[model samples]
Every structure is written in C-alpha cells, then in structure tokens.
Target: MQAQAFAPRLIAWQALNGRHDLPWQVNDPYRVWLSEIMLQQTQVSSVLEYYPRFVTRFPDVQQLAAAPQEEVLALWSGLGYYSRARNLHRAARMVVDAFGGRFPETREALETLPGVGRSTAAAIAAFAFNARETILDGNVKRVLTRVFGVEGWPGERNVEKALWTLAESLLPEDAASMPAYTQALMDLGATCCTRVRPACTRCPFAADCVAHQQARTAELPAARPKKVQPTRYATLLLACHGGRVLLERRPPAGVWGGLMSLPELPAGELSEAWLAQLGTGEVLPAWPEFVHVFTHFKLVITPQPVEVDALAPRAADDTRQWLTPEAAIEAGVPTPVRRLLEALSSGTLSVSHQIST
Candidate 1:
C-alpha cells in the first residue's frame, strides 16, 4: 500500500468499520466536547450514561454556564477527576462571554478556552469544524506508537513531542475530510489497536503495522515506570442530628473544593479541640475507618460520627449545615462522605467503607 493512499484507504475502511453510535459521534461539537471532557481518564461505557444526562440537564453552553456550580458538580459526581467538570463549566462561561455562546471553530482559539487542552482542542476543531488538526489522545498515541514502532514511553516530554509530530504527519487528508478522518483514527485506535488483546486480524492497518510485522505489537507502546502513589491518612468528623447531616463546602481550591462534604478534623487526627471548634458536644466512640483513593493520593478517613441536637444552617463557608440525609446527597458531597451518610442511614456505622480507594 502506498503512503499517499493511506488517507483514503483509512477513511474508506472507517466509513464501513468505525463505531458511529457513540453519544458524541453525530458531528455535534457541544456533545463532542462534553463527552471528551468526561472521557478523560474515564472509559466510554462509563461516560455513555453520564453524557446524555448531563446534556439533557444543560443542553448547551449557555445552559451549562447558567446552572449552579453545585448542581453541575453534583451531576459530575462519581465520575472522578472532578476538575474536568469544573473546567467544562468554566469553559462554557468563557464561550458564552467571549465567543457569543458558541464553541470556537478553529483549534487555535478553542485551545485558548479553559480546559480545552491540545488534544481536546484538536478533537473539537477537527470533529466540529472539519479543521485539519491532529489529535494526540491516549488511544491515538498508543496506535501511532505501535503502528510506526516508535519506541519510547510517551510520558516523556521528548517522546510526547515526537508523537505529536508523528500525529501531525499522519493526517488522513485535508480539512474537508478531517471530521470523518479524525473520527476514523479515534475509532480505529479505540476498537482495533487497543492496549491489550488487539484485533490484529480485523485491523486494516495490520499489514502496515511495524509492531505487527515484528511480532512486538503488545510491547510497542512502552510503559513508563509506575510512580508510587502516596498514601495520606486523615480524619473526617461526621456529625448528624435530627435527621440532618453536618457538611462544609471544601474551600474552592483544594480537593473536592467547591463541593459540600462532611466536615473534617485536622488532616492528621481528630481531637477534642477540633470537635470544640465545630461547636460539638461529647463525641461517642470513633466510627469505623473508611478509605477513598485519588490519582495522586490515598486518603484514610478515621471518622467520628457525633450525634448532635441541631446545627445552624447556612451556605458553605466557615460555618456548616444541617441538611436532611437525602438533601445532603443532593449537595455534592464526596463519595466517601456519601458512603458515611449511607452507613448512618443504614444504622451500620461500625462497618468500614471503601470507595475508589
């Protein structure tokens, strides 16, 4: 097969072979961007349900921009990587303000928007505007690395640069066919050139794949040495009274920030003084420990569920709230907090809760 004919060949192959039923596949930029954001570090099956519900709630940029941050964060709960939701909302506001409520057309301007990084920008530009920009998402990176036998861990700066160059050079055609070609490349990578157990016999590019030719397909995409994820131990104080739970909004900067969660003691341990700071009375025995894991850190929350008489209600600030258990669920607490509440509602506080940990 001639290199010059690769573009048409791939497109032809994809027109017949590509998966077209994805939630974002109908040539809609808004859906594409939304799905892309959610799909980051998340799988497609997971995003399928989230994508439709989110779009229905906030169908367009303007609607998304206007929705309350708490509601938006609530919708995005459980889809770990909360920053993506925050960035999506922030970018929506910017689009409404700067671009007349429409996502930008070109990759250059789209990249300027919040959360619209290079790969996402390229995807929107190509998939939305038919602009001939190349995307280097994880799937494409693996496909390209394996197809061309590029031997380097893509996490390295130099390796990433080389991969981007390879991606740009591999453009299927010009801007006109970019929408189809972009989708084709992504589809091929996702379904056929997968990380493990690729469908080599069914892949159109198998004959041309250097990794396949050398029987090194599985090893073509070199793995970067794993970094030891740190373990963080913290104490969470869960206080409830009269069917209401006490939660504080995380300051809009740290983990789970801008989202209401069960108030915590100091990062290390729960002390009587900390409970006093919460204006609480005598605390009973400590609740069973629960754990929540994030990308960079693992949190061990030693909870102290204090039964209180009442809590003065107010917005998330230095103060806390006395929300009904169900209302607390709607207030965007972290998964662990929700689990703790579940334990309380179920009258099983002694049971340890493990979530994403």
Candidate 2:
C-alpha cells in the first residue's frame, strides 16, 4: 500500500467514527499539551477524570505556571507518574518565562519543553496549529505496525526508526486535515486495533492491512522481552502524636518524588533505631506487607507505627511535618500511603486504636 493512500481513508473514517469530543480536543494548546502529558503511559478514561479538573483549576498557561508545585501535585495525586506533574509545572513556567505565556506554535520550540518529546510536540503542533507533522505515540505505533506489518519490538531503536519513517511518509499533503488524520490514527488503534482482541472486522484499514491479510495481527508488533522485576524492601515509620502522623517530603526526583510519605528507615535497619531517633516508643504490630510495583522493580513495604509523647524536632530546613490523618490524606501522598492514612483515620486498623507503650 502506498503511504499517500493511508491518510485519505483515515480522515474519512475519522469524520464519521473518530473521537471528536474529548475534553482536550478543543483548539487550545494548553489543554492539548496537558492532555498529551497526562495521557503518557495513562489511559484515556483515567485522563478524562483528571483533565477537566486540571483545566478548571489552572485554566491557562500563565495560571498553571504561577501555581505552587504542592498544589499541582495535590491535584495530580492519584494520576501516578509523578514526574509528569513535575514536568508539566516546569514546562508551564518555561512557556511563561521564555515564550511569554504562550505555547510555541512550532514543534521544534514545543520539543524543548520538559517531557515534550517529538511525538508529543508533533501532536501539539497538529492539534493546536494544524501543522503537517506526524505523531508516533503507542496507539499510532500499534496501528501503523499492524497496517504495514512492521515486525520487531517498537521499543528497539531500529524498529522505532522504521516506524518513524513510516509515520512521516503517511502524512497527508493537505495540512488542513492534519488534526483529523492524527486523531483518526489514534482512534482506530484505541477503539478498533486494540492491544488485545482487536476488532479487525471494524477496522478501516483491514482490507489492505498486511497483518490482517497474513493473519498476524497478533504478532506483527512484537512485544517487549520480559525480565524479572527485582524486589526491594523498606520500613516506613508511622510516627503519631496528637492524632497526626509524621510525613516527609521526598526529594524532587526518583520514585514518588516530591510527594509526602511516611518517614522511611533504611533497608534492613531496625525499627528500634528509627523509634529511638524520634523518641521513646514501642513498635506496634506490623501491618500486612503490601507491594508497590514500579516500572522496573517491586517495593515490599513494612509500615511500623510508633506512638510518641511528642514528635521529634526538625531542623528549620526539614521537609518533615506532623499532620492529622485527615490532613495527611489531603496532602500529595501516593496511593498506598493514602490508603494507610485513610485506614488510620477511619479507625479501621487495629493498631490505630491501641497505642503500644
């Protein structure tokens, strides 16, 4: 199939079938960029819940740029991928400072923003400026690899380069249709050519799709090779005094960056030492071990509660705080940590009712 022929059919199909009413599909670059960043490694359904709230709160680039990072992270608490929130804040500031509070119309300028890669930059250019640029996000990659039967894992450099070339070649000459064309590719993959159980019968490209013809729709876009995710252990100190739990702000990088969490004792360190470091207290019975999985590793968390007469003193520069369970829940703690706090606040946990001497 000629690369030129792909867009017309996609555009026509999108006219009737593509998503036209997503919250961020409007002509605003701020909304488009926000949606794109939130959609990274996240699903449309999930993004839908967060997008409108974010837009209502921030509304525009200038407002988002000026909002405090804690406020932004609080709004983004359950969205996962903490770095996206951080980068979105940084990028908004950059746009305000460097571009005078306007998103750059060109892909090149957009790409310079934090977390805006080539594909994301291209998306903003097409949707916001109607620029004739190609996007090769995961959905597009799946759709193209199946239609064109490009083999090998899309994560590989060579495989990705080939897909990029294919993506660029398929761009329609008429720049006016760029938004529809780009959206068509995304919708086709998301709704029709899905990762599992693709509805090929409903796919617009099924007739000429090489993977369909060869009955290899399941095989063309190779999966990433699997490796065992390593497990790590940590003990979190749930120091409580006057109904408040001790929370520490993690550094603004790495896992759960910039989020408030329970104080952590070093791996393999005794709970006694952490308790002594704070004040005299007895360790409560441990909560059931819980696991939090990251992209590359699994964290086995042991939460130990300590009842203290007074919270430990902190240096003037410390990020630690003692907030009531209600307050901690409102803070930007991760999902699992939030669950623990909620349990404590609700008195559903046995340990919270009984203070160990």
Candidate 3:
C-alpha cells in the first residue's frame, strides 16, 4: 500500500462527502473537547441534542469550572457513563487553574488533563490546533483493521499497539491537512465503513481494501471474547410525603457515582431503622421490579414505595433531599431512578393505605 497516497484520497473524499455541518466542527478547542467527551460511547444524534444545551448553559471552560458538580451531573442526567461528566468537570477546572483557561495546544499537554486519553488528545490537537496527530478511535480501528485485513481483537494490547503504529505511519505529512485528514478517517468509518453492511461500493478504498478484495470484511477486526455479565440486586426506598420523594446523593466513585438516586437497601428486605427514622409511615406494596444494566453487571432494583406522614428532621439533610417527583426527575438522578420518579409523578406506581393493609 502506498502510505503517502492515502491522505490525499481521503482529503478529497472528505471535501465532497464528509460531515461538515456538525455543531462542533469549528476550531475552538473547548467545544471540540466537550463534543469529543460527550461523543464517547454515545451516538451523534444524542450528542446533537445535548451539545447545544450544554454549551448554552456553560458557554466556556470558565463557566463550566465555576458551576457546581450537581449542576453538571443534572445536565448530564440521561447521558450514561456519569464518570465522563465528572472528569469533564475536573478537566474544565484544570484548564482554568493550570492552563490559565486556555486549552493546551499540544497532544502531550492535553493528556495531562483528566479523561483525555491518547486518541482523544490526538483528535483535540488535530481538530483544534491543526496538529499532525493520529487518532485510533473505535471507528478508525475498524477501518484500519478491515482495510489492512488485520486479525485479532482490537482490544488486545499487541493488536492495539500495532494499530497505533500503523495509524501514526498513515499521518499526513503536511500539517496543514491535519484537520481534513483526521475528519476524513472518522467520516469514512462512520458513514461508509460501518460495522454492519458497509457501503463498500461507495468507499474510496473499496478497490484496494484487503477485506473487500478477499471477501473477508466480516472476518477481519475480530470481536471481543464474550463473558457472562453477572447480576446484582438492590432495593430503592421511594419514600413519598406531601407529593415529594426522597433522594440521596451517591458516593464519589462507583456505579452511578456522584448522581442523586433513591436510597438503597438490601433486595427483598427493608431496614426497620429507616422506617423509624422517617417518622410514622406505612410501607406500601412494593412496585414492580426492574433491571438497570451496567457495563459490568446487571442491577435488579426493587422499588419500595412508602407514604410517610412527615420526615424526621435528621432524615432530610445534606446527603438527602425531599423534592417533588417532577423536580426529583429533573435532578441528577440516574435513568432508572428517573423512570421511577416519573412513574410516581404520573400516578403509574401508586399505592393506597388500603393496598398497604
């Protein structure tokens, strides 16, 4: 393969066919970085809805850094992977404190910031600084694997190292072409070289692609080894009083970390201490059980709705709050917690005093 010839072809194809109208296509590093973080494991359609709203709220690094973590989590409520939001907040503060509110220009310098890995730094540098950096994101990995007919799971350390070396070797020599070339690789992978049912006929490299030529597109870029994801269980206390539900802030690190959620208990059981602490309350019939899947395990949640007359003064403190069901849904709650709140607000999961007895 002629390494020098690849960039020009990709650049030309990008000019005519690549995405240009994305909201974050500009030269601003802040917007580029924000879009990249949000785009991680999330679809463009979802980012499109979120990016504008997030930017409008925070506007810049300074604004984001100045905002409270709760506000940040609230804005990122529905977006899975809450840690990204936490890291983004930390990175924003670092940009303000360490870089004097301006993003570092070089990829190496950008990597010092939290959550900015090698590929992410490369993308930020290429897009914002026009630096000649190479990115090997999932899309690019797929494209390279198929184009070169590279075997083995891309997640393997050796395979990833080879892909990185290959990616760096393919970098466009002229720094001026960095943005277009980088975008071209991404656009090609996203639009034409899709994981399933690739549009090989429309691909610029279709004629020369090894996988296309050998009819082994499906076989190359081996899938990750599968394992059975284990399941866990927890019970959420949906204590309601005066049209408000109780919520507790999660610890700083773990599953759904730093987000507000329903107070949890051991599955299939309730704590007598919690009942006594919430003053006189009737533990109504438990709501339907549901499952919230994480990357590592499945969380089977049983929501126990309780109608309390009044809360003890200590029950609702800094760690916990009583907010209207609608307001609680608007808070920094997880998706599953949000669903439960919505159900409570809409009377979809109601329990009467009669139902309790």
Off by over 4 Å in 2: 228-357
Model 2 lDDT tens row, 39-151: 99999999989988999999999999999999999999999999999999999999999988889999998999999999999999999999989999999999989898898
lDDT of each: 0.81, 0.87, 0.89
Deviating ranges (above 4 Å) for candidate 1? 1-3, 226-357
- Give lDDT: candidate 2, residue 25: 87
Give the alpha carbon lDDT tens digit for every residue of 138-174 in model 1.
Answer: 8888888888888889999999999998888778656
Deviation in Å, model 1, residue 134 alpha carbon: 0.5
Residue pairs with clashing backbones, model 3: none
Score residue 49 of candidate 2 by CA lDDT.
91
Looking at model 2, report the run of 10 residues with the lowest lDDT sum: 348-357
